[model samples]
Target: MAYGIETRCIHGEDGITREHAYGSMGTPIYQTATFAHPGVGQSTGFDYTRESNPTRSELERIVSSLEKAYDTVACASGMAALSILLELFENGSHFVCSEDLYGGSVRIFSTIGANRGLTFSYVNTADAELVEKAIKKETKALYIETPSNPTMQVTDLRAMKALAEKYGLLLIVDNTFLSPYFQNPIDLGADLVVHSGTKYLGGHNDALAGFLCSASKDLADKIRYIYKTTGGCLSPFESFLLIRGIKTLSVRMERQQENALKIANWLKEQEEIKGVYYVGLPEHPGYEINKSQARGFGGMISFHTDTAETAKRILERVKVISYAESLGGVESLITYPMLQTHGDVPAEIRERLGITDNFLRMSVGIENGDDLIEDLAQALKGE
Candidate 1:
């Protein structure tokens, strides 16, 4: 029987048959570096850990199923996954990317990619015309982050897909903000879907991992080749943790979204708050577009305090929410993008994107909605 997404999350799409690992209910972690050959010429499917491992393979399969992709490549980190995807283009090829992306992404593209002779043009991808105008003959890809990191800018995937088709360019989406449970970019005609599995997919701030999923066999093969060659694959133990985290993704996302909406609304009512940038809020520019394309508005919210001093005070005073860098964990995290996630971005660009000292980004967790709101209220009140 075909199952719903919730069912798929728990039992997986294929329903977890016991054929793979000697009837064990849970997928076994294959920790060895190398596998022995059955005979002189025959060998086990897995030869080396760097090339492939059973545990990581299972994690990749589950993620691919979730994204409805032909295949997925598991990597050491989100940047590693992006590095593999960038390998599709030749050294001199260029890409048009979202202006307000994660700071680490911008750092890598500007430093590492630039060192390798790859070039990128940063634009607000929500404006399809601007993205089109930014593309040159050397541009090979349209890379974007929807409900963009820290800023919560949403890009229309269908519009980007149309542009990519017209220019014969690949459409790569960073789906880290909204996990596959809320948004599936591949279903919207994305050529490649990338994620930071360490965030929502892991659910806990425990493991570090990344994933790249694609429906095109050719693209999948190219990613796999680069992934194996670079040797930045996720460890088997981390893969096991990722699988455990993914099982509860549906329930966690629902609770997180609920809490986020309440918090965002409460923030808007507070006199100390300047603005709230959450896709769920009707005042947000991309609220309607996000509603049309995604199942949920997601739990990430960025708000500005009346002053930079107030922002710093709240960061130090929050007892319930941890002051941290990462997001999408069970525990709520509040980060100052100016000195944290977007610190690497140039000052001019950061100012233009509104990632300023007065701004704070929150990743709402599965905590009780009222308690979270009360905690924020107390923090804002300097109690």
Candidate 2:
């Protein structure tokens, strides 16, 4: 029987029926550098922790199930996944990427990737024509982040897939914002889906993990080969933590998005707030496109305050919502993109994207909507 995403969250696609020595409620962490050989000219399935581990394999299986991908690789972090992914393309290959992406992605592509001979064109992917215009003979892929980081710009994935098909280019999507419970890019024709499993998949400010899920055997094999060679596979213990965290994925995402929608609505009515960027809001430019593709708008919201001082002061004043970096945990977090996530980007580009000093991005937790609203209310009033 096909399982719903909620069921897939707790029990995975196979339920708890996988054969294990001890029938433990949770998947056990292998926590060993190497696995013992069964006998001469024989092996135990796994030979080395870096190549594969039972715990990490289980983590990959569950994430693959969530993404509806042929397979997935558990990585040390999101950047590691991107780094390994870059290996699939030859040197001097160009990629058409979304402009409003995670600052770290911009940093990696421009610095390390450029240093290694990979070139990138950053465009507003919300406009399919703009993305197409950026493409050329050297372009190998279209890399985009839907409901992009901080600014929440939503790109039409199907349109991008069509562009990829026309150009014979790979379509790579970062599905970190709306976790697999809410969106599966593979189903929409993306060749690969990327996740910073540390955020929603791990669902706590605890473990750090990332994943690359491939839709086809060829892509999966390529990712696996690079993954094993680079040795950036997630540790056994972190894999176990991520598996534990994913078991609660459905509940966490629902509650967080619910809180996010409420918060977005409240932010719009506040005189101290100038703009609110959330895909859930009907007034948002990409609202309909997002609703057509994703099951939910997710927990991230970006709003601009009346002044930069108000933005900074609210970060200091909020009691219920903490001011910090990283997101998709149980605790609500408000971040200053100018200083935090998007700090490395050029000032002119930051201004063009409207990610200014007065802008604030929020990761709504599963906190009570009333409590979160009251906290925002007081923080805005300087009470």
Q: Write the per-residue lDDT of candidate 2 for residues 1-383, one digit (tens) a residue.
A: 99998887777778853556577777877889998999998998999999999999888888889899999999999999988888888988999999999999999899989988999999999999999999999999999999899799999999999999999999999999999999999999999998898899999999888899999999989888988888999999999899889989999999999999988998899999999999999999999999999999999999999899999889999999999999999999999999999999999999999999899999999989999999999988998
Alpha carbon lDDT of each predicted model: 0.91, 0.92
lDDT, candidate 1, 1-383, per-residue tens: 88788877766778774556677767788888999989888878888899899889888888988898999988999989988877778889899999999999999899989988999999999999999999899999999899899899999999999999999999999999899999999999999999999999999999999999998999888888888899989999999999899999999999999999999998999999999999999889998898888999889999999999999999999988999999999999999999999989999999999998899999999999898888888888897
| TM agreement with the true structure for every prediction | 0.98, 0.98
- The C-alpha RMSD in Å for every predicted model, in order, reads 1.1, 0.9
Query: After superposition, which runs of candidate 1 have C-alpha atoms over 4 Å from their true positions?
Result: 20-22
Clashing pairs in 2: none
- Which structure among the candidates has the greatest lDDT? 2
